[model samples]
Target: MTDISEVFGFIKDFGFPVVLSWFLLVRMENKLAGLTEVIGELSCNIAAMRGEIPKR
Candidate 1:
């Protein structure tokens, strides 16, 4: 079995890259969320113009 210390050592060695990747992922998630909100609003507007309820 691998020792816990070894795991921690590996993380310590690559922590910066891991943290950077997490930061980038979070930023991407936020941007995608904003884009999703904008798309939802646009869809609602289009549906209103067509006199139909947006698909639930």
Candidate 2:
């Protein structure tokens, strides 16, 4: 009984932060992917504006 209680107590203490961290990491990964794509697009646009790239 004490072991079960201890397990629950530990979970209560640490589970929420672990879950929250995992969720935030997943969200950040997606956001970073999107940001990376935007940065690539921006770089191409700048190069095109400077005539470093041929017009499409």
Candidate 3:
């Protein structure tokens, strides 16, 4: 079984900044993924208007 103290100790050793940075990175990645999807849709829309094949 895992000990609770071990987990807390690990977090304490690493500090809050590292954890915060990871959190921020994950949030940024999610936002970037959403932006990528929106860009893809916009590109497809433009391609349709131009009557050109949109390279996937």
Alpha-carbon error at 53 in model 1, in Å? 4.1
Candidate 1 lDDT, 1-56, residue by residue in tens: 99999999999989989999999999999999999999999989889889898454
Q: How accurate is candidate 1 locally (lDDT)?
A: 0.92
1-56: candidate 2 lDDT, tens digit per residue:
57898999999999999999999999999999999999999999999999999756
lDDT, candidate 3, at 16: 88
The per-model lDDT (C-alpha) reads: 0.92, 0.95, 0.91
Off by over 4 Å in 3: 1-14, 54-56
lDDT (tens digit, per residue) of candidate 3 on 1-56: 77999999988988787989999999999999999999999989889788797555
Q: What pairs collide in candidate 1?
A: none
- Model 3, residue 5: displacement in angstroms? 17
Winner on lDDT between 1 and 3 is: 1
Q: Is candidate 1 or candidate 2 better by TM-score?
A: 2
**Candidate 3 RMSD to the real structure:** 5.6
